[model samples]
Target: MPILPRVALLLAACLAPATLAAAPDRAPQDVSGRVLRATGTTTSGEGIPGIAVSNGIDIVRTDAQGRYRLAAGAGQTVFVVKPPGYRFAEAADGLPAFWRTVPADRTAGAMAIDFTLVAEDRPAVSAPEVLLFTDSQVKSARDIDYYRRDIVEPIIGRHPAALGVTLGDLVDDQVQLYAALNAVTVRLGVPWFHVPGNHDVDPGSTGDAASLATWGATYGPDTYAVEEGDAAFVFLDDVVVRPGGTGYVGGLREDQFRFLGNYLAQLPRERLLVLGMHIPVFDTGGRETFRGADRARLFALLKDRPKVLLLSGHSHVQQHYWHAAKDGWQGAAPLHEYNVGAACGAFWSGAPDAQGIPDATMADGTPNGYAVLSLRSGGGYALAYHPARLAAGTQAFTPAMALHAPRVLRRGAYPAWGVFANVFMGDAGTRVEYRVDGGDWLPMRRVERADPRLLVENVADDVATALRGFDRSPEAVPPTHLWRGALPTDLAVGEHRVEVRAFDRWQGEAVAATTYSLQEAGP
Candidate 1:
């Protein structure tokens, strides 16, 4: 049977029943379209030599011209899944690129569902909403069950558009957990995509070749793109592990880098780019180090782009940094890097909650929380932190203390000095205070513009002195304190004092004081 004639016959047979069931006034329906690479200035790619199409059940590979004719009942949804080494543009809302519809009439001619599979820049469609998850380091089937119940179920309940992306650490080196995790997540009624994290790698395996073979077999690809709505998403394998190595480092191989360069080159410069990886591109604290070479190369590729949002999960803490021209990138707009918190919630090692979720906190002292990012059209996004194990109305911070300046620093002579305080589980709207020596107490600036889970209290002063009384212990949680104002100018060298007091949203206040000494100017 000839291809076109055969398709015509198949269409007729499939729509005959639908035509009879519908009112004469109603149109008989079916859809047909060619899948092609999205090429230069074109919405569709020219028919490629070979490709496949499926109507969510029946599957057909495209012919030499990248065209596939599939039979569908009226109103049935049809979509094309890109083969290995190929990708579609990300949708506006960060979804896999797919088009759907209900078939009209079979004889109405095949509905042209042309696919433009470009070798380079792909179109990103906009989705209504997307869910982002990071660090599902499930070490055992039990862990997998926990993730499914605690994290996956809640997200699916929301019925988000499409599925979600796991930022990495999908497994804890068990390798077998991949299947269990997928089995649970795939039931969310949407497709789930993943990136590779350090924990996902096999420490016993060496080189990209061996590890990637295992990874690709379990996960679709090491790197790929999908368009949901109008946004483009690039998932990269940043977790580079050496065979026989227990610890992993962040690096992108030459091939991956080349692929990214090619992919980015073809994309519309104005479109939004959401790059997800296992490790962060930038590190804030001195405690957690960054892969300088890896980051530098990645940044170099991104330097030309105007709107790029980097999403990473390795830090296991929630942090947001906006960089315009840091570390030698010439990006037109500032790049926003969001470090999503771990799903294991401090490696599932912290205090267990009522549901048995562990209290996972990163080493740098940031609380464990996932991030919700809304990628908007025209290159912008809003990020919010959702703390794990906490209900919507939970208060994260409590302020403590009030300060009186002059009474503490009366004998000291100096220009200005500062005070420091702390907050216990600080949240939005907590307040603090500062004062000058023997002066009236005044409200101090809140470090965080909005509510924050933690509060940092500091004071400004001149005369230095050691305030007596309160015992300070390194192991003890710092007292949330408020500071009394500025110190006096010019005084005999001696001991002076400063104090900090903090106020919690729920609790009252507490004070902590520190003293410093002033010395005469050296000759």
Candidate 2:
């Protein structure tokens, strides 16, 4: 539990804020905004009441006249919650614009921030699909070109999703590339939301407040919310910039908690709560990747909520984690968090395809790709991963999982060897089974071992004398999503089809296949 702040600080926070470290002693100014409904025919004015507005710490709903007033300190942002059934205008770079950053120089007068949304043709749908891209991590113009060709061109004009969001690391420490990235996204023609990753921070920043100046200028707000379909999506800037070139850590700021407290209080209990950020809340390897106290506080806030999903992306690999009693999550069921795979898997390293795009396979053998998050009618959701391109220039259908097995085995020999299946989106309890020659399915053991597929590439790179590509593929790491099944060599000498099937909780059954041959052993 957090203690109450001083009366003066309370007034400064306006929305009743709680902080682990108190903000500087500075008076806040009143910030007012009006939510207006605009159309192609009418321009005069139409107030839209009940629209949520915020000053980064406090949330306020528009009054009957669509007006709201909240307090904000210097360097804060004033933003409007984009609700369903409406559309916002595009920024100069073609990104959906929704927030205004308060000038750091302003100290005295009231600030006015207004937002206008155009009415849509249809009401909010029961289910909405979102395209999820993480850690694009583009560092230069060429990388951006690879991003467009490899990640964007395939989905262009297809409209595979109603909306899109980049979970973070939009660039690799090159803040200027944000514009170039959005320029490419403009072609997708969907309202895209962005979460700032640690790499998105400006290198010259003096502190956390100053770090995202470049990001805020282009992407709007460091933290904000959007209401779509049956879910409320809350985006947070959880990457805390350490002072004096100490790098960064995953943690929440006091003002974010304040905004969350105020906003969650007003949200309906029946709607799904989708929390998005750049860093995973779970501590990595007991090394405290995220502040444990902040995670506990966030879990406490969601303890009473029935439907919640945490989405984050930072590590190049993909994974799913759950919070239990040990992690201080008190919800009725364990909390589920999806640490999504990076779009620029392993920093876009690996051998290039015919298109000059790097294979970009993750060290764990997951392809460099994006995910589709299908928000269900009720509180349920479904998810699927789409690889940007096939591995090693293969033209086969996008595989659910990659298979690695020996092409031949000695008959009448011990079945010591096995097949390894790297389920790109698999988790701990995923049901994985394999069958031979369409025979009965047998459970495949989940094993934490390097995906042999990448190990082959690793071996290829190790012996190469020259540069393999833009960069060599990441060294293979034992991934949690791998499964293994022993190969039986006692079978008759012939080619046998081996099919592995796994049930993904999000997308249901997935089946992939390969083959092996057996030959009689010589005396």
lDDT at residue 251 of model 1 (Cα atoms): 70
User: In model 2, what is the error at residue 65, expressed in angstroms?
Assistant: 2.4
lDDT of 1 by residue, 1-523 (tens): 1112233234334443343343234323445567666544465546654444445344444555555566666545566644333445544333345545553444554456665554533233342345677987888877787687667677565654444688988888888777678778766655567888877776576655556544555564566665443456778888766556545567777767775775565456776778988888765455334577767788888887777888888765555566646554567766777677677655655334567555443432344445555655556665544545443331222112222222233343454544433332333345655443434666665342211112221111112254211211111122212122355545555765554555643235655454555565444
lDDT of all predictions, in order shown?
0.55, 0.82
Can you list the residue pairs that collide in candidate 2?
Answer: none
Please write out the lDDT profile of model 2 over residues 56-94, one tens digit for every residue: 776766655666677776777788887766667666777
Question: What is the alpha-carbon lDDT of model 2 when measured against the actual structure?
Answer: 0.82
Among all candidates shown, the one with the greatest TM-score: 2
| Residue 293 Cα positional deviation in candidate 1, in Å, after optimal superposition | 3.8
Candidate 2 Cα errors over 4 Å, as ranges: 1-28, 40-44, 105-108, 392-397, 521-523
Ten consecutive residues with minimal summed lDDT in candidate 2?
1-10
